[model samples]
Target chain A: MIEAEGIVHRYPGFSLSVSRLAVEPGEVLAVVGPSGAGKSTLLRLLGGLEAPQRGRVHRRGPAVYLDQTPYLLERSVLENAAFGLRLKGWPAQEARRRALGWLERVGLSGFADRPARALSGGERVRLALARALAVEPAALLLDEPTANLDPANVARIEALIRAERAAGRAVVLVTHNLFQARRLADRAVFLLEGRVVEAGPAPGFFQRPADPRTRAFLSGEMVW
Target chain B: MNEVLEITLRSLAVSSAATLIAAVFGLPLGLWLGARGAGRLARSLLYAGMGLPPVVVGLFFYFLFSRNGPLGGLGLLYTLPAVAVAESVLAFPLIAGFTMAGAASRAEGVRRLVKSLGGTETQAFLTLLAESRRVVVAALAAGFGAVISEVGAVTIVGGDIRHATRVLTTAVVLETRKGELERAAVLGLLLLGVTLVVSGLLVVFGEREAA
Candidate 1:
């Protein structure tokens, strides 16, 4: 379980101020907004990428954070996947053993020994997913995970996210693609600038966004 | 010429010695400054150090170890240790500056992700270095080039003592002063060739990184 209590993060010309936010253990929350809408900022704050100036981000059990930019190591795919687990004091052999399972889970079984630098864009995303999942995080936080991916990879990533939720982990994903969010999100949060103006079940929010910003967002109108 | 060859070989050993010392003390310092996000201040100090006249740097250390000075009793002046001191000074800034830029640019997002994963401070920094190994390797090349090309500091501090401090660059100068420009040119061109060789190696690494 993850709960964000009055989170506030300040950046030049913008800020993210969420009063209260929480996700059920097995829920999937989609954070949707246009560019500069603080979607990534909120994800970073929650993911411990950036510390919030006020309030707190509390998480139970282990968590993994994946950013839009895949920070792949200059090593083989197997090594990249095993980094976090190894840090947690898993022996090299055991870490590699677990990494193989996650890589296979993300459909990258054949790429275990491949250098991470050589992976394609979609393959890189898949590898990033594999790396994050290798820790078996109790919760997963991803920022624009599928933004640069093509349609085929997007479907695969969506499936991967859905599968994680089905396996009973909290998943928080940030995206600008309304269609993608509509497909994968169980609940939706509409962010305008840095504030969440609408939050509800995905279907209801897609059909009837309460705030003007949310409605404008759903209809492809520029609200920021 | 044979005597010069002996000096050359002798100097290569000394320079390698200096480079090893530099690798030990300076590499980790570079990694430290890089991981912590020291901005223009650190850069200015490094660039200023890089641009330091080798003779001036030698003079500074020379004064420190001279007979009446603080470390005079240690008798490190006019020795290979003196040369290594100056060489490391010259190499330190190069090692740190280039390494910092190289590592940070390559691992910008890794720090954030690693911190989020509950990694310790040391683990976060180490993760950046490991993630950007090619960049760190390039930094090592840059450091090597700076230390090896330098003639002024090592020559001055090491006193150009025959069989002790008469390195490639200093010997090249000695040969030139004696009107052996041909030999000087040979050494000069060899120095240039070494630079190119180092550059070629870096380019190979860069290409591999690009891949």
Candidate 2:
């Protein structure tokens, strides 16, 4: 479980203020917004990557945040995948075993010994996802996990996320792809200028957005 | 010929020891300052230290280790250890400052990534250091290069005692003063050759690891 209330983060000329947000286990909440809409900031705050100036983030257990451009260690693919496990104090052999399992799950088994920097874009994302999943966090906050990928990789990643939700982990996905949000989100929130514009059950949010701005955004007319 | 060889060997040993000592303390200090963004004042001081005059460093150490000065009881003055200590002092800022610059540029992303993985503060720092190993190596090279070619600090502290404290740089100075210009030039070339070989080896090693 993850929750934030009265959150406010500020930079030089912009501020993000979200009154309240929560995600329950076994649920996926998709945050949809235009560029500069603070979706990534919201994920960072939820994941404990950044502290909000005026709000508290409460997590029931560990949370992992995957950045839009994931930062992979300069190590072998297996080492990268096993990093979080090693941090959690797992024995090296056990961590490697578990990481290997994740690698196979993500279809990266053949590339385990390869240096992480040698991987392609899609492979890098898969490796990152595998690394995050290997840690088995209670909450996964993902920022644009599939910004640029082929349909097959997207399907694979979406399936992995669905599996996490099925296993009773809370997921907060930030995406610009409305179709992806509609497909995967149990509930959805529309944000604009760092404010929640509309939020509802995913089906209703897509079919009958209550706010005109949400409607404009859904129709691709809101460009910013 | 044997005397010249001994002097060259002593020079290498003193400078290598100095570089090692400087790196031992300097790398950690640089990593910390880089990871946690030093203040402007601290950064300014570090930059100034990097360019400190070797003669001034020599004078400072000479005073500290001289009779009636603080730490004089150790009897380190006019010894090889005294020369090594002086060189270490001269080299510390070069190692630390360059390492700081390198780490500062790359630490933030590594820190955030490590934190998101539920790693502790120490883990984050270690990971940052590992990721910036090349930077650390370059800093070590800079430190070694600075100390190996230095004559002022070693001369002041060691007194360049023949067959005892004389090193390549001081030997060159002594020979030149005695009008043995050919011998001085040979010693100078030997110093340059050592510097180039060590630097080249470090670069090659770094590249091999990268590959």
TM-score of 2: 0.91
Residue-level lDDT for A46 in candidate 2? 96
Give the TM-scores of the predictions, in the order they appear: 0.91, 0.91
How much does each candidate deviate from the true structure in C-alpha RMSD?
A: 2.9, 2.6
Model 1 lDDT per residue over B1-211, tens place = 5875676566656666666677677667777777767688887887787687888988989989898889889999889888887787777777777777776575567676676666777788777766666666666677667777788888778888887777778878888999999999998787777666766776687557432
Clashing pairs in 1: none
CA deviation > 4 Å runs, candidate 2: A150-152, B68-73, B177-189, B196-211
Minimum summed lDDT over a 10-residue window in model 2 chain B is located at B202-211
Task: Tell me the tens digit of each residue's lDDT in model 2 across A1-224.
Answer: 99999999998878899998999999999999888988988999999988999989999999999988888888899999999999899999999999999999999999999999889878888999899989999999989999898998899999989989999999999998899999999999998888998888889999999999999999999767
Q: Please give the DockQ score of every candidate, comma-separated.
A: 0.46, 0.55
Tens-digit per-residue lDDT, B1-211, candidate 2:
6998898889889999999999898999999999999899879988999889999999999999998789899999999898888899878998889889999987887888899999988999998888878888899889999998998888899999998999999999999999999999999999999888888888788656641
